[model samples]
Structures are given as C-alpha cells and as structure tokens.
Target chain A: MRPFLYERADQPEAAVIAARIQGQQQAPPTAAAAQFIAGGTTILDLMKLDVMQPQTLVNVGKLPGTIEMSDQGLRLGASVKMAEAAENEIVKRDFPVIAQALQLAASQQIRNMASLGGNVLQRTRCPYFRDVSYSACNKRNPGSGCSALDGHNRNLAILGTSDKCIASYPGDFAQALIALDAQVETLGPNGGRSLAFADLHKEPGDTPNIETQLQPGELISAFVVPTGAWTRRSLYLKIRDRESYEFALASAAIALDMDGQTVRGSRIALGGVATRPWRAREAEETINGQTLNDETARGAAEAAFRGAKVYSHNAFKVELGRRTLARALLDAGRMEI
Target chain B: MGFSMSQSEKPGGLNRRSFLTATAMGATLPVIQQARAQQAESAPADPRAPVDVKLRINGRDQSLRLDARTTLLDTLREHVGLTGSKKGCDQGQCGACTVLVDGTRVLSCLTLAVMAQGSEITTIEGLASSDGALHPMQQAFIDHDAFQCGYCTPGQIMSAVACVNEGHAGTNDDIREYMSGNLCRCAAYPNIVAAINQAKNEMRKA
Candidate 1:
C-alpha cells in the first residue's frame, strides 16, 4: 500500500477543496491526487495491489448516513452502508429491485462496510487491470494497451467496448438505479447539482482511463429514486458461477407496470454484460404495451442483446445475458405485488 | 498450532495457517506470487510517513503511530497484539480478517487503521466473557463441528453472529446465503449452518 496523508472531512464543500483542479476532465476520479474515502472498500483494496495510488485521502465519514422514503420516492444519503440500505424496510417492501441488488452484491462483511455511494463507482474486476504486474491495461495505464482483449476475455463487457478496453461495469446496484431512473445529487467545488444516474458513467470510447463524468472535486451526495407504478413490481436477477459472494456473470434489473395480463410500461437495465449500467431502451420498447408472456419476454430479451459484440471467450455472455433478462421479466411478471 | 499443516483436520486441532500457501500450492497466479514479484520490483509509490492513531479494541483504548498504509488488521495483529483475527487474503476477497466495527461486521483488512479512529472494534478474542465462558456462537461451533482446519473460523463466527443479529438468519437458506462471505476451504459449510442455527436460538434465549 502507498503511504499518504489523511484528513477527516469537515463539510462537503470543504472536502473537495483539496480535490479541486483547473481542468481534469481527461482524468478519472481514481486518478486524482486527492480523493474522497468513506467505506474505503474500493480505494483500499486497489491501493494494496498498487492499482490506485492517491497522494491524499479526505475521509467522508462526517457525511450523513441515511436512507429515507417519502411520497415522492426514496432518498439515500451517500454514506449509507450497503447492508443498511439492503435491509431497510421501505426499500425491501417498495423497491425489491434495489433491495435485491444490494443484497446480492459482495458479501456480508463487504456490504456492511461499503457505502452505497461508492458501490456504484466500483471499477471493473478485469484481472489485467487489477494486477499491475501485467502492465497492459488502458484503464490502469492509458494507451499502454489492453491485455484482456486477447488474454482471458471471459468476464469482459460485450455491449460497451472500444478496441482499447472491454472492462465491464462490475456493479448490480447501479443497474437498479439506472432502471428506476434515479437522480444523483453531487457536491463539487462549484456547489451542488443533480444529474441522471444514466449520465453518470461514461463509455470507454477510446478513453477508458476517464471513467465517470464527475469532475476532479465532485462527490456524490445522495441518490433519489422516484417511485411509480412499476416500483412495487421491480426485481433484480443475477446469475453467477457461485450462488453468493461472487461477481455477476450476467444480470438483469426489470420493472414493469402491468395492465392485468398486458404490460402498461417497462424499465430495463442490464449488468455483467456492459461497460456501464446499460439501459435496454430497445427491450423496454419491445415489452411496453405488449401482453406479458414467455414469448414476449424472450423477444424483449433478444432485443436487449442485439447489439452485443463478443470476443473469443465471452461469446457465451450474449446468450446467457438474454436468458437472464428473459427470466427476470417472467419472474417479475409473476410477482405478487 | 498455527502451522500450515492441519494434522487433525477436525474440530479442536485446526491450524490457522492452513489459510497460507498450503492450499494454494500449485495454483496459477497465486496472490502471494504476485505480491512477491511486486515487492521485489514494484513501482515507486511509498511516502511512508507515520500517522498517530487511537483505536478502541475489545473495550480498551490503545494509541500507536503507524504508516498511513497500515490496515486495521495489521494494527490489531502487529501493533495491538490481537492475532485472533487472521489475514487469509490481505485483500477484501476473503473474509478471514472479519471484525465488528461499532457492532456491525466489516472486513478489517480493507479498513485503514488511521481511518478507524472513532469506532469500537470487536475481534474473535473479545467474544469470550470475562468469566472465561465462550460466546454462544463459539460453543455452538464446537458442538456442531462447524470447522476443520479452522483458519476461517474467526471471520465465520463474527459474520454468523452479525447475521443472526441482523435478522438475516431466519431460515437455513438465509443463514447459508448471509454467511457466504466467510469461505471455509475445508468445506465445513453444513456444520457451520447447523452451528449458526443452534447459536441463533441460544442467542435469542440469552
């Protein structure tokens, strides 16, 4: 682990003071010399492996850790731990997709320590990016090259991949947030602002090193997920080699507003098969106003993966991802809401 | 008893160091191998300035100066002399470094010592009573033979206790799912589930 300076955060505005820069749009938040640390799960783990080496860390422990629900929707403070939000009564009852995504992620101890804010920002688990000994990662070392392109590409992304990087967005909760149309509130050196969750993550597009749209000093403050007719009917389904404590091989987050046996509306997001929390607008369009059935669900699933590009090892993901989405739709359709 | 070889491979005589290179001996890309190669010729990133950290462990406050790189697990083992918490995987992948921070289970390996200033940490050694009585979960593990080569037992026990407290141990399936964080290489999973079930009832009674 690299030695660095640590300062407890005084205020949101003050926290970013050290992190503020002139124009760092080209650099990822992980590349910032001074970064925010709350749960320290991602930053600490990567630092020990020498993946991320920030010169200074501003502890965000002083931020409010809260999960509150109202008539509008659910509001989760950035500091709320994954375990706390996963087991929150309102989240489990009103938004099963959010609850399931949090529950299925990481492990008991990791969920307890990791913050919901940081959970979405977790980097890919691409083996080449993790082990610095490889030295051929576009994300780790920009323009060095991508080893996963040819070597062990089983877990890489298919939906969002440039020739430079194929690292999949390794998060489930972000899929739920994107599907539910959550809005993220952020505090930066300039002040506070809100952005749609869908716009938060950037595609690899040649610059795999710059991951998020967040500025050098910006920090995620809260996530507000608006409730609707589909909120009670939503579910997140994850498929993996192991039942628990493992990253997703393929996953789906689905929310449907049903009109008896027909679908009134649909919201779909995919995971483990994309570069970011990918919104399957095509699948949602296919399912909306259509009668909910096995055949229709399969059609929507096929639409979801129509644009998938597969390499040598990860070609199975296109099929597996389709099945996972279809299964989520069928299961969610049959849900007793 | 901390040797890498687990002669008994049973309840009482499980060696903690069974978590070392013994099980991973012929594996490709072992973490230790990468760590060894990195240590010999890794990139220069060390600033190595000691920071003063005061931590409350098992109801006692201890103060020490440590590098910013020192994790809570290292502080407990090397600085404060609490070796009950093992470092199975120094990274957060394995839960062998599990401990309770402010009564909630967390991976000590991922928590930096300086950052854990205010929270009270409870490790495996703190589970026993002052009168020498073991925690119900510990007793239950012994009665159910929940471990063999008990390297991951501390983390498992800590996680199981938290699982029950968190009301995630309502059924056998719940126990299995919630306790999946702590990996037992000996595959003593069934026994661990039975132990958690037993202790859940006993803990409720107490």
Candidate 2:
C-alpha cells in the first residue's frame, strides 16, 4: 500500500480527464508510480503477492456508459462485472459460447467481481512473473532477463513468443472474444477509438512489457462484439490440468457457419499456447468448402499448429493444441444450428 | 423467662453481613433483567462503513455504508452481517464465496463492495425468512444431508439458487457443471446432488 492520490470519475470523459491530470501533475511511476484500477481482481491479487506495486490506484468503477447491451451487440463498460455480462439474457442466448467461456472460467466469486474490460487486460499467469522475489521477468521489470524462457516453460507460449518473454495471455473471455471478432473501444487523451480485439494485444517481441495497444493514460471504455447469425453456433473448449480453477494448457474457440454438411466459414483462435490470441485463419481457410470428416478435421488441426515452435519442456503442447482445435471444431459442427 | 430473653437474642442473631447480602440481591434483579432485555432487543450491528449506498438485495432496497476495498462477500458477511455467505477461498478459486448479484450467481470475493452498491445482491442469508424459517434450499441440504463439515454449505446453497435461477439445474450434468464453482472438500457430491434435486422439487411445488 504505497501512498498516492485517489479519485473517482463519474463519466467516461471525466475518467480520461482524471488520468491526464495525474500524469501531468505527478512524476511518472517508476515501478512505484500511478496505475488505473478496474475490477481490482488482477491488480489487487498481484499487489497482495507483491508482484505489482502501484503507488496510485485511480478507481474507475463509477464511470458511466461502461455497461450496456443492445441490438448492435454487447457494449460492456470497462467496469461491467464479468458475472453481469456472462449472465446477460441476450449474451447467454445469442452468444452461448462467450457465456459458457466466462462461466467456466474462474469460480462464481471471481466472475462476479471481475469486469469484461479487466478480463481482456488481465496479465499473464506466468508463474515467474507472479513470484516477485525472483526479479528476472521482463514483464515485471523491463530489460530483466526472462528466467521462464529456459526454466519452467511448461505453461509458456509457443506462438508469438520471443527470447525476451514466453508468457501466455491467461484469459478465457479474451479467447472467446477473439474468436467472435469483437472490437475494443477505448478513451484517451486524444478522444475515443476502436481497436479490433485481435489487434488489441501486441506480440511479446523484444518489448514483452508492452502487452496491449492501449496508450498511456488511456482507459478501455467498452468491448463490442459484432452480431452474426453464426454467433450462436460457436464454442470455446479449454483443457486444463485439473477439473476447476486452473489455467489452460491448450484451449480453442471455434465459430462455425455451415451449409448442409460442408463448412461455409469459421473463426478459430488458440489460447494457453500462444503469446496473443492465436487466431488460426490458415486452419479456418482450409476447412471452408470442405466436408466435415476426421481427415479434414485432422488437416485443419495440422494447419493450426503449423508455425508452432515449442521449448524444451512444452513440446507436448503442439500435439495437445492440435487435438484441442480438432475437438473444438467437431464440437461446433455438431451443434444443430 | 423465654419471652423475656427473645428480644435480646433475636437482635443479636440478626447479623450485618446477612442483611447486606439479602439487600444486594434485591437491588440487582431489575438491573440484570434490563441488561438481558437490551441484549435481546439490540439490532444486529451495522458492519458497513458509513458510505451512502442504495442497493437492492433479494429484491428489497438495502441502504448501508461500505469500505472501498471491502469485497462484496465481506460486506455481506461483516457489514450486513449476512453470515450465510461463507468465505472459503478469498482468492475466488473456491466457490465458497458465491452469491447472486442481480439473479446471476457470482463469486463475491472478487467483487468490490462499491461496485455492487446499486446492484441487486442476493446472499444465502437473505434466502430464508427473517422469522427463523429456512429457505427451501436450506431444507434440501438438511433433508439430503448435503454437507459434512458444513463449512461449504452456504456457498453450496448460494450456487444451488443460482443454478436454478440460470435454469442450468434442469439435468444432473447441467447441475454438476453449473454448480462446479462450488467445491466441498469433504466429497459431498452425492448429497449435494440430492439436495439440489430436492430443492428443485420444492421450488416446483411452490
């Protein structure tokens, strides 16, 4: 609990205004500076573990227009609780995959307090970053050598990973959003802008510390998922080490549009095995116009894992990833949509 | 001769210590009775800090003050003193902190007190009547003997309410998956399942 100023913003613009003022008046937080607080689920948990030490926590839960839903799809304010979005009648009925992904994620208690925007921005659950006494993490302290690259890379990413970092984005809701082609809306010093949910995450190349495209002093306002008839035909499949409350080893989110027995188009993204939301367009393209079968499924699965490069301890993830994709595809296809 | 000696004898037998003891007991009875009545009549202590909040809980207006970082679970337990909502794993992994905020079962540990300030919060304590009656879910737990150590019973009951509220309690598999957030380390799955079924029966009958 470092001493710092605290302010609550009532409107979205007011939130931006507050951040701008803090950045201007205060010295830049150097491992001891200011940081905006959302649900406090991820940040506070890390703070308790001493993994994150923010001097200032700008409370943004009271900002308006953060939670809303309409015919244009869902508009979740940065403060909207994960439990609220997951249980929205429209979300559950229209986007069952997203609902299921959220519900099956953390326990009911976490989902209740965690927000959709916070879920998207949650840091990697890489064991190295969480253990603070070991300060060899680039994400925790930029330019610090990553101990996870060679040591305990079991839960590390294979795709979009670099020598600087091998941390995986450990969010179930983000995977579902990536598969659904959702967009993230943000408010900053300049104003508001939209970002494709896929592009929201940056590759951990060299600068593993810079995780998202969000600029300094900018706050995520909402995440909107585009409406599609195939939305109801999507599925998120996660395979973890245990039955509950565990991060995934290899997970897949699949959205399918079928014409009779043949596939029309599909959206696929892999989680738990990638540095970002690992979208498999190559695999998706290979499956379109193709009839559903074990052979085609296996081929698409191979395409999904084509560029995967595993470390010493995580070579098993490539095969597991392929199986996860295959199974998710089959599951989506079996849906009687 | 006996009557003449009685006046002096009686006067001498009446000791100062005995007279004082009797007098003290007579004087303390009213004070003791008033203390007991006050103890029984005193309202449950308000645990919430004095922050103006108007939230809905179990379809009723709830007004209270709360700490900024106090988790919804803590607020329900300490502030509102709704102890039916148990705190097992405050880290949100254990479903022991489950409660319904606006009809959806959520983990209360992860939620902030201020965030749920205006939301409809339903805790396990509010599930039953204020007159010492048990909610059907509670009765189901008792009838089925769903809990062993009973530490996770409130969480189990809260999840059961949410399972039905979400309509995911239609089948055994659905109930298992929907109630998956709750964990009873005592391995009370069979009894939990029976309790859920009994609750469904009771709910349908209602």
Work out the TM-score per prediction.
Answer: 0.90, 0.78
Once fitted onto the true fold, the runs of candidate 1 whose alpha carbons sit more than 4 angstroms away are A21-26, A70-72, B1-47
Q: Compared with the true structure, what per-residue lDDT tens digits does model 2 show for residues A62-132?
A: 55544456676877677787777777887777787888788778765567557777788888988899888
Q: Clashing residue pairs in candidate 2, if any?
A: A29-A33, A66-A77, A108-B106, A108-B107, A109-B107, B48-B79, B51-B65
Which candidate tops lDDT? Answer: 1
Q: A1-337 in candidate 1: lDDT tens per residue?
A: 7666565554555455434421133466779766788888898989888999876676775567688876658999998999889988899999999999999999988898888889999989999999999989999999899999999989989998999999999999999999999999998756789999999999998989989889876999999999999999999999998999999999999999999989999999999999888999999999999998999999999999999999989999999999999999999999998
Highest DockQ: give the candidate number.
1
Error of 1 at A100 (Å): 0.6
Per-residue lDDT tens digits of candidate 2, residues B88-184? 8786667887888777777787666655656788877678888878888899999998989999888899889777756778988878766777889
Please provide, for model 1 over B79-112, each residue's C-alpha lDDT reduced to its tens digit, 9 standing for 90 to 100. 9999999999898987999999999999999998
